[model samples]
Target: MSIKEKIMSDLKDAMKAKKTDELRVLRSLKAKILEKEISERKGGEASISDEQVIEVLMKAAKQRKESIDQFEQGGRDDLVDNEKQELAIIESYLPEMMDDDEIRSEVQKQIEQMGASSMADMGKVMGVMMSKLKGKAEGGDVSRIVKEELSK
Candidate 1:
């Protein structure tokens, strides 16, 4: 099933399971998606492509990550826990995450392939990495690791 369809299915399951938090997050996600699609359709019959949908999902996950960090920093454990649960639900729409070893190896390969010798070559490395990792890895995380590797 498509990601949109999967979200609807999961939403039903969450409702059935009496998972209020999960249901809330899923409903918000569906709203965002439908909003985008409606906006996209304003000009014609164009609907959001799967890639755009993934971008929406990534944006949601990133926002939740920021919220989690801020909640932790501010000593709001309750908010942090809520953000964690929301993030978990958001991530269910994304593909499996890449671990450190995989990210490092992929960054290395991209750096070498792009002949990125120093921080000056950072943009090129990022271009390759972003295209390869896309929704699976956070861009900030990739950039930090690439900078560390190049500085070595």
Candidate 2:
């Protein structure tokens, strides 16, 4: 099943199970999709591709992560907990994230393939790496690690 169908199926299951938190998160995702679709329609309509949906999901996950960090910093434990739960729900629809080792190895591979040497070569390497690792790795994380590796 496509990601969209999988999400819809899970939403129905969450509803049947009375998983209020899960249902709420899923509804928010649906709303995000609808909002994107409506915005695109105002431009004369466009089909929502799976890639666009995945991008929305990724954005939601990133937002939750930031919110969690801010909540913790502000000492709002309850808000942090809710953001964590929402993040968990958002992650369920995303592709499995790469571990440190995997991301490092992938970054190294791209760096080598692109013949990157000094830090100045970062843009070239990053451009290729981002496309290859899209949705699989966080861009900021990859950039940080790449800079460290290249500076060596």
Tens-digit per-residue lDDT, 20-136, candidate 2? 999999998988987877877855867577777888899999999999999999999999999999999899889888987899999888888888899999998888888988888
lDDT, residue 6, model 2? 76
Candidate 1, lDDT over the whole model? 0.88
Q: Please provide TM-scores, in order, for all candidate models, with all chains considered together.
A: 0.89, 0.90
Which ranges of candidate 2 are over 4 A from the true structure? 39-45
Inter-residue clash pairs, candidate 1: none
What tens-digit string does per-residue lDDT give for candidate 1 at 9-122? Answer: 999999999999889999999999988888888667766777778888989999999998998999999999999989888888888888777899999988887778999988
Candidate 1 regions off by >4 Å?
none
